[model samples]
Target: MREKLLGLVALDRLPHACVLESGTAEERMALAKDLAKALVCKSGVDRPCNTCDACRKADSGNHPDILYVGPENGRKTISVETVRNMRDNAYVLPNEADRKVYIIDPADTMQDYAQNALLKILEEPPTYATFLLLCTTKASLLPTVLSRTAVYSLSPVVGADQSDGQLEEAKGLAAELAKALASGSETSLLAATSAFEKKYELLPLVLEQLGLILRDALVAGSGGEQMISGAGKSAGSLSARYSNAQLLTMVEAVEDITTALALHANKNLTLSRLVSRLAAGM
Candidate 1:
């Protein structure tokens, strides 16, 4: 994920707005700061070249063009007024560098009104401005907010020792399901999904892992090299087998089932619906 992100920076292809998610607070903040530094760095392509004045200023948190916005006055939530203020500041020309970077930490804490305020600017950000929204989960933000920005997960795939038996089993099931989806065989897909028929307890983990696989597929299909899901071979096959649109549909289907299961919906019925959705996507 780091390589892919830096590659985008080097290629000057990073999106104007992005959501960086799924890591510890410190990890996410560090990454956001590094990316901000890179954006404002004077070195072309080789950004954040530590020796540059911009990089030095960024490292010291003294860069005028790199701003950090979050809850103020010990408040737990960011208010709409605060977001509007940031939006207004975003329109101003950069003070030092060619670009302005705003790192919005704890973006998940923003209420609906605050997010809508942010969304207004996100919809039409200044050409010189870039916004990085940091959160533990992208689901905490509104769908409209998600649609307007690129999303990247900072969570590394769990290692074998870090995973319990159930998680390991879920990973296997997820890999099988990914391959099944790529195969476009309803029987194969059903067989892969059958593992979750009565195992309500493992359904969430399985769906989560499966979602990661789909994320990998999207990255792979877009010509990205790194696979954060650790299912590189399956992701490759999926990328080769499906178009971006189909993969997005599959992703939404997984998300819907995961959300339903979270709300204490009937596991069997949700699982059935998930299978139908996947098959339809194919």
Candidate 2:
């Protein structure tokens, strides 16, 4: 993902709008800053040359051309007025760099109206401006908002212990689930998910791994590199078999089930709902 972003920077092919999805808020913000720095870096081609003035300012979090937008004054949600203000400022020229970059952290917190306001600028962004929307999951953002931006999913770092026997079992189950999903067979899907009915403790890990597979599928479908080594074949088949919307729906389903499990919801019911959702979507 770093290489892909850098290549885009070197080629001056950064998208006007982008969505950075990750499970960790810090990871999303970190990458957003790196991309912003690369975009505003003074060195042409060899961007984010840490020695450049832009890179230095970005490192210090004082770059004028790079702006961070979010809920203001302890507010939980970003308001339409705030987004409108951002739109107004987006028209202004950059303070220093050749391009102006706006980083909207926790973009998923925006309400529908606020997102609509953001959509206006996304639809007709300034040629010299770039927008980076950071969120924990793409499902939080509206489909219309997602359609206008290039989406990048970042993998979270797993502990060494997670790479043990349990992880392997989770990966196997996740692969089966992915292939079953792509096969469009309800019985296959149920049989695949049945493994989770008894092993509730492993369901989270299985769902997490499944999310990665779907993420890889989305990336592969968009012509980016796949992240999961063991799931590459499954990801490739999923990419070829499902539309982006379908894959995204499955991703959202995984997220939903994960959240439900985290809340101590009924395990069997949650797993059943997931299967039903996937089957209905298909």
Candidate 3:
């Protein structure tokens, strides 16, 4: 992915509005930072050369040409005012770098009006401006907003040291868990549940995977891209077996169970009840 993106940089063919989606927020931000470095790097060869002053400043988070925009203090969504500000700033010339990069992490959280404000600029961006929007899912944004951008879907990574087999195994487990719940197969669900389900420290991660499965199912049913890793087959199956409402109910059950887990509720009971609710929904 880096090679392709950097190749675009080398060819001077970077898109004005690019949307990259990933299953995890951390990966999106990390990739956004790397892309920002490439946009601002001054090296004639191996763009985004980490040793260059531009790359060093980008690493240090003080690059003048790069901007980070997201939710304001205590806010859930990116405000329209923020989008408006970006619209005005995008027209200005870069401070020093050849291109000015705006990085918006978790772009799925942008409010409707905020997205509208951005759509205008995206349609007619300045030659020196580049916008990188990192999101977990593209379904949340308007079709008009997505039409003007180049979209990229990133695969999930558990850890640097984790092998590909282990990562695929984890995604397969999550897919099976979601498929069983949607199919109302209690036996399948029981077999898929791991002992880690009972560990409070691991509950959040477990629930997040389940939630992603259901959300991806909905996205698949609607002909949108899925954000969950290695769950494409399961998502296809669930989308065929369930309606939008059913998928939403399953997602809500998983979310509720997650909230219960976060509140320090009994894991055994909560997990059991969550399964029951999911089966009933199915």
Which is the better candidate, 1 or 2, if ranked by lDDT? 1
Q: Give lDDT per model, in order.
A: 0.84, 0.83, 0.75
What local lDDT does model 3 show for residue 35?
85
For model 3, the run of ten residues with the poorest summed lDDT: 2-11
* Local error of candidate 1 at residue 262 (angstroms): 2.3
Instruction: Please state every model's RMSD to the true fold in angstroms.
Output: 7.2, 9.6, 13.9
Misplaced by over 4 Å in model 3 are 156-282
Question: Which candidate wins on TM-score?
Answer: 1
| Local distance difference test, candidate 3 | 0.75
Models sorted by lDDT, best on top = 1, 2, 3
Off by over 4 Å in 2: 156-282
**Candidate that would win on lDDT:** 1
Instruction: Give one digit per residue, the lDDT tens place, for model 1 in 145-245.
Output: 99899898887556657557777888888899998998999999999888876666787788878777777777778776645577888888888999978
Number of the candidate with higher lDDT, 1 or 3: 1
lDDT of 1: 0.84
lDDT of 3 by residue, 8-38 (tens): 5643556888898865788778878988998
